[model samples]
Each structure stands twice: as structure tokens, then as C-alpha cells.
Target: MIRGVRGATTIEKDEPEIIFSEITKLVQEIVTANNIQPEDISSVVISTTTDIKSAFPAKAVRSLEGWQYVPTMCTHEIDVPGALPMCMRVLMHVNTEVHQKDIQHIYLNNAVSLRPDLVK
Candidate 1:
């Protein structure tokens, strides 16, 4: 079976290091809470709203756990009028037997308001 976890977060500022750190922490939480394994991850996709061009969120975590070879892609989100600025989102396709409801998705910082349904 396969499952997917979705997460989003916002940078408190435009700082590159801060953006990278926030993404690293959030990705770690999402993976741990869902009991995900590096090998179990099929693919990961990330998107940032225009204001967040500092770093690709995917690179922050993938490098930490030697997941550097994972299939990762980053792009820009749809720039709707009045959308959240400096936001980064991730969709992880995982090869797991867990049910969709059992997978714990994450939304951190200002982005936590984006998906009120899932949070700590």
C-alpha cells in the first residue's frame, strides 16, 4: 500500500538559513510522526510561493538522512491574489501500508492556519 502526507509552512522572514532550518524541522516532524522511512518514500514534491525563493525545502531534509538520491522536485505555487507569502509546501508519496487517515500531515508556523484540520 501507499500513502501521502501533505505539509505546509511559512518563513518568519526572508532569511535563507531560517527558511532552511524551519523546513528541516518540519520535514523531520512529519516523517517521524508518520513513521516514514527514507526507503519508503517514493517521491517528494515541494512548492514555494514567489516570496520564498531562498532555498528548496526538499534539499534541507534530504541531505540530512543521506536521502540525497531521493526523487525530489520543487516549483512555484499558484500565485493567487492575496495568497500566503513566503510559504513552502510538501507532498510526500510514501510506500506504506498505513491508511490515509492514519498518516499525520503537518502544517507549521503561519502556514498552520492553512490546514486547521491537522496540527499538534
Candidate 2:
């Protein structure tokens, strides 16, 4: 069956280096948490708040070893007043045998507020 893994993180700034580093950390955490291999991922969809425009988070995911073949896309999150800033989110579709209820969703840094219920 196909399952979706969700993750979110915040960057200190919109600089390319920061965006790259934070996204890399977020994706790595998700992969590690889920015990997912690159080949298991079908696609990764990433989005960032309006304040983040220095780089696309998907670019950082693509930089991961063995992830070049995974389908990925990036987009802008809806601008909402009072929303968290510098937030990057990812939805990874994976072909796996894991049950939906057992899938782990990661929320890191300031983005943890976005899903307090899912925080471990």
C-alpha cells in the first residue's frame, strides 16, 4: 500500500544555505524515523511559507544520495496571517507495507506548534 509521511521544520532565515541545511535535516529525520529507503519513496512534495524564497526545499531533498530518481515538486504555502514564518513542509509518498496509523509524522523546531498532537 501507499502511505504518506508528513514533516515540517522552520529555518532561521531565507538564505539558501540555511534553507538547504534545515530541509536536509528535516528529511533526514523523517527518513530515519520511518526507516525508509530512497527506493521506497514515490515522490516528495514540499512547500514553504511566503517568507521563504531563497531556495526550494525540494532542491535539498534532491541533493540526498540516491534520491535523484525520486519524483519531487516544490510550491508556496498559502499565506495566512499570524502563521509561523520560515516554515517548510514536506509530504512524502512512499510505497510501503506499514499501516497508516503507525506512520510517523515529524514536526521540528518552531513548526512543532503546527501539529502539537503529532509531536512525540
Query: Top model by lDDT, which number?
Result: 2
Cα RMSD for candidates in order: 1.2, 0.7
* lDDT (10s digit) by residue, model 1, range 1-120: 767899988887877798789888778888989888788888889889988886777777678765887798889999999998889898999998887888899998899889887886
* Consecutive 10-residue window with the lowest summed lDDT within model 2: 54-63
The C-alpha lDDT values of all candidates are: 0.85, 0.93
- As a whole number from 0 to 100, the lDDT of residue 62 in candidate 1 is 72
For model 2, how does the per-residue alpha-carbon lDDT over 1-120 read when each residue is reduced to its tens digit? 889999999988889999999999999999999999999998999999999998877887898999999999999999999999989999999999999989999999999999999999
TM-score for all models, in order of appearance: 0.93, 0.97
Deviation (Å) of 74 in candidate 1: 0.8
What TM-score quantifies how close candidate 2 is to the native fold? 0.97
